[model samples]
Target: MKLYVLSAGAGLLVGIIYSLLNVRSPAPPLVALIGLLGILIGEQVIPVGKQWLSGTAFSTACAKAQAVNHVCGQLPGRQQAGQQAQSAEEKQS
Candidate 1:
């Protein structure tokens, strides 16, 4: 998500400044970042859940969830494409 990227960029910028100043970063660790990402995803799930509960159709809710999955690079299609590319590279080699 844009929020995650912006947060990461800000953290990186702050980290560089901290290194230049020879001071420890006050920022949380990578684990905390992962936890924050989980929370962000969990928050998005609520809306899809509400849509499902309101009988808006499973496909619609799934589409919303799939968008998140795709953005996170967890989609099977993406995985297959990577595998195909790797196979092609191996064949050429």
Candidate 2:
């Protein structure tokens, strides 16, 4: 997001300078507005930026978390471990 915003700002500054160089002779409002919008959108859509996160970020995160929980939660309890023959003998003594 920061990169996108910065690029847009630089584009706007350049646009302003270029417009001034033309003496602002009957400057078109729509042209400036549309140009700025185009620059902003281009900044976001282009791979030159890391602003937009991957679409799979959230989905992959969710799957990893669920897998971790499933593995942890299904693990044998200490009580079950202690019921093994060696552990049971130790406990009985």
Candidate 3:
């Protein structure tokens, strides 16, 4: 029982260190840089993508996708204008 416990503890320690030292999510710096750039580009691209997106999601476009893009682009401006108008009306009353 004591021997088994010691072996288990040793195995656990070795596994932990092996995972720490040999584990890698290694990416080439160029590849990582390109991936990061892709994300930034995609942020801009995804909105444009929605306009032409079809309802079919797999190969083409999606309706929800377009709606999300449309709302995200328009909502803030609409809200700000509404708020300003409301404040002006409140002051007049």
Q: Tell me, by TM-score, which candidate is best.
A: 1
lDDT of 1 by residue, 39-69 (tens): 5566567767887888878768867557466
Instruction: List the global CA lDDT of all models.
Output: 0.71, 0.55, 0.58
Q: By TM-score, highest first, what's the ranking?
A: 1, 2, 3
Better of 2 and 3 by TM-score: 2
Q: Which candidate is the best by lDDT?
A: 1
Model 3, residue 36: C-alpha shift (Å): 0.6
Model 2, range 1-93, lDDT digits (tens) per residue?
Answer: 999998899967876876777735245788677666665545334332232244546435434334333333443344467568777799899
lDDT: worst 10-residue window of model 3:
58-67
lDDT of 3 by residue, 20-51 (tens): 76643354677557655654445555654765
Candidate 3 Cα lDDT to native: 0.58
Better of 1 and 3 by lDDT: 1
Candidate with more favorable, higher TM-score: 1 or 3: 1
